[model samples]
Target: KEILLLLVADMKAEYIPPREDVIMQNESPDELYIIVSGEVEMLESEMENEQTVWTFKSGDMIGEVGAFCCRPQSYTYRTKTLSQLLKIRTSNLIEAMKTRQEDNIIMIKNFLQHHKKLKGLRLGDLLHGVGGDYGDPNMYVNLLTVASTGNAT
Candidate 1:
């Protein structure tokens, strides 16, 4: 993926052996990691317990929010296999986002829609405020409208 490659180029590369634990739950670190090769597991911990959340493969982006918000990592990341990663510091990503405002806007819009859907919000209701057909084009228009209104949807 071109975007992945571009982001990776902005990061520091590292090779990790299989079964290596990369991030710990609740640990504060502001960095985004791109998987260049192999696999990673995202996990959650509660009351001294750990649970797997998802598995990420090559080209997958990890730690986006932690990087953007400069917050503690909410999940733990572990190497499922021999993994190569490109680690982008939060400051660099923030600068990149600033330089690419359009990309950031689009990404945020998509993320919001996806998050709403995941939370069981109906597509119709999500588009109700915009009063338009629900489609990719309409989604962009809604995003633009929300942006113009100084309210990012």
Candidate 2:
């Protein structure tokens, strides 16, 4: 099963040029972009203030929660330099996963892991309570489990 997923069909990739003053702080729009190459900076916005949260590189997935939930974006990401990305529409990803069950399962696992890592960081930030920091790690884990089991709602 793992081998089958490793051999699954690959998606097309796209390239983006560097831009100045890119807003890395905005609500998520539920889109997933797999970083094929280049760099991106993640930022969070609160009360007219923006802070750099993280930097993503190749093989990293962005906007997983939004892609899963079909909700507003929770963070903002901007290219730190010229970048190449595989833009996977959430609807298309969901459909493809349905067709390729094994591969879909692997993808779901990867998404869940990424979600957990992000959720942990966000939860820690919330504990500090210096910003509009609010997140539920358990809820995210539950969502992933439900979605992967084909019981998402």
Candidate 3:
């Protein structure tokens, strides 16, 4: 899937005020969020106590692990400041996945593995499908080019 265009075409942009939870820990996962502005805090609940695990800022994509895996959200994501996010419904992604062949599954799996080290805006930048200073534009171009040409080298 062309996640950038898919998000632009299929997601909804929402503005969230500060100190509000975008999603709560253990909530039923429904959508993936891409941070467009401001910061978000990721928290985990343990024995009724919440602990901050990580912080996501503009350009970060969150809630995908649970949504893509069809599981409950593992952490709470709250706005640390005023924020804007693009929300992609899990149902949309599932529908898209259903239309793809087996190779797309592997491609998505590899894509997930490749994205593990990326964070926040940098990751978001890559997902936008636009070449930027933070990520190599050629990577996406090359990947698509190869796929289109039926070459896997």
Question: Which portions of model 3 show Cα errors greater than 4 Å?
Answer: 1-7, 106-115, 118-153
Model 3 lowest lDDT segment of ten? 121-130
Error of 2 at 64 (Å): 1.6
Off by over 4 Å in 1: 1-9, 107-153
Please give the RMSD of candidate 2 to the true structure. Answer: 5.5
Off by over 4 Å in 2: 1-12, 20-30, 115-137, 146-153
The number of the candidate with the highest lDDT is: 3
| lDDT per model vs. reference | 0.64, 0.62, 0.68
Candidate 3, overall lDDT? 0.68
Please write out the lDDT profile of model 1 over residues 45-73, one tens digit for every residue.
68888777677789776666455434456
The model with the greater TM-score, 1 or 2, is: 2
Candidate 1 local lDDT, residue 46: 81
Clashing pairs in 2: 27-73, 28-72, 28-73, 28-74
Error of 3 at 42 (Å): 0.4
Question: Sort by TM-score, best first: what order?
Answer: 2, 3, 1
